[model samples]
Target: MQERPPFKTLFAVPLHCEGCISSVTNALSQVEGILSVECHLEHQLVEVEGTAAPSKISKSLQDIGKDCILRGSGNANSAAVCILETHAPNVENPVRGLARLVQAGPEFTIFDISLKGLQPGIYQASIRQNGDISNGAASTGGVWEEDTRGTEARGRLGQIEVDSEGSGGIILDISVAIWELIGRSMVLSPGTELFRQDDEATLVGVIARSAGIWENDKVVCSCSGKTVWEERVEQTGKGML
Candidate 1:
């Protein structure tokens, strides 16, 4: 009889539709240490079962494009499982992530902007006000646009050049939350394009092989004899392939 650690921090959120849920699920599943996930569209609450810290969870959720807020936690009489492994892709230089911008559509345009001086790796790709929200993320790569939407409207926003003067900015390992477009940049809308790499933005990630493992876990209440099983998730290799 093994006692599992308690799960914590449930997140309740509001997504536009079932498509939104699918997008969120796909994004979060890429996280390395997540244990369980229950996304209920009826209540708009995504119950993520993991043993990681809340800050870590919050960052991960943001990376995947979730407007997540804490709700509650329960010590359910359930079986808990944990996994640990490494994986890589089959590409020369593989990024650690592969996100599809599930917002931008086929007609989203990436125009240059200039309120002043702009830098590479970081630029604001203006979003057309009259574009479809389903277009997905707007970036210079094909990864986000593929999983998020497709390769119909792949384009660049702006390039980024890292400053090496020492006072470097903080970097996030969003290699998991591949992106596309959403809300309008100059304007505001649901389908508006959301991601941008302005001059101030720094690119900090490595392309490598991705490898992961799948674990079959079940929760059985040692006291009540009730069981919670049939849970699974796919660990993907990012970057290389």
Candidate 2:
């Protein structure tokens, strides 16, 4: 397997003094894929550089009694995101998963995907040619074609097994560019086959550009007048991972 290159990710952490910085640094050092950790006490921010999944980094901080919100990741114009949702009839909450994509190197992009409220089975993830989700996954076109690597189907992102709790995730690098994925769509389907039109279990979402490292620094939402942590609490209550 090719080693994944390290990428930078910024987090909004609550830091007050040198002790807080030490605690945060020490906690991150224990996480297996982290290459380095930098804390900015004045901004209450932590910059992590490595192959560690953002979710794992956040969990590590949570374990140390410090909550963190990912502010940005990767380099400028090298990050994107997608929120997978189900459009099945009568579904109260459509959101079922999230995908974070970052260009870690010139040859590939890293994908950190998580799914919840799904059946216990294997799910196939793929990038589609179209971003349409009006009729759910059915509306999204076929797998994106990689002209440079003809017949290779670079869009196929392999599979993730959902556990009994309907949760599954995978973190790995794919041979695709972040710019190429923006405005496209990602679909998660049950089983080894690509998504079928009738499969209600299918989750689909459009990929959108996300902030790169240091691109976003606001600690509060101007529209909601809520701090990052406050917004995080609300989002957590809504089943955001």
Candidate 3:
């Protein structure tokens, strides 16, 4: 059988100058499965073409002190993206990821989740509301719903199976409005096995909900009244679009 072509992904990172671009391009080119790396400094974007796992690419850039947010696979319309992070203090192996929501129809959305640094196995993922965990609280229990008390599964996102390299991706069909999902979070937890055990450690970290959906041609920044793309375009110009 013939090998498949490498996939491409865009990352919104901190790229300020030619030096930064060269550094990121060189660093990504060294990754084993990466086929090409293009840095758009004006837009602070790094476009990577590769068969390597998405998480691996994100981690490599992060390891070199370049924080990045996955911006989807070259498509920049009507999408919301989040950077998933670990909140556990004592855990050694940390989980990191990117969750993207794309409008599929009137009332349905597709969730594209890519994660790294997880144990190789099956895991359950769900969308959770921001509960009573006050903002000033020391720890919000990492936002994983503890029991069935007030937590009801809104949409069955999908199952993610991490490979031996601790990287995985899954597409979830969500039956909800994009507007309804803005401030809520996504959580990855152990499968039903954890339900039987009284262990709090079964909880995984909360996904850092970042951008909201773009309605029509407008950028949906509830606070600033400007969309993220609009701000990027204003600073970087139409070339980014």
The candidate that wins on TM-score is 2
Worst 10 residues of 2 by lDDT: 144-153
TM-score per candidate = 0.29, 0.93, 0.47
- What would the per-residue lDDT of candidate 3 be over residues 147-202, giving only the tens digit for each residue? 44333445335568878897778756556556676655555665642221212223
Q: How many residue pairs clash in each candidate?
A: 53, 0, 1
Clashing pairs in model 3? 219-227
Ranking by TM-score: 2, 3, 1
Quality of model 2 by C-alpha lDDT: 0.88
Which candidate wins on lDDT?
2
Per-residue lDDT value at 93 in model 3 = 40
Worst 10 residues of 3 by lDDT: 193-202
Tell me the deviation in Å of residue 165 in model 1: 14
lDDT (10s digit) by residue, model 1, range 1-241: 1222324446655667988888777776776556777777876667776544334555577786775544443332111111111112232332222111111113221121111111213222222322222222223233334344443323222222223331111211111111223322221111223343221221112211111111112234466565322111111222121
Please give the lDDT score for candidate 3. Answer: 0.57
Weakest lDDT window of 10 consecutive positions for candidate 1:
77-86
Error of 1 at 213 (Å): 28
Model 3 bad stretches (over 4 Å): 1-78, 91-95, 131-153, 193-241
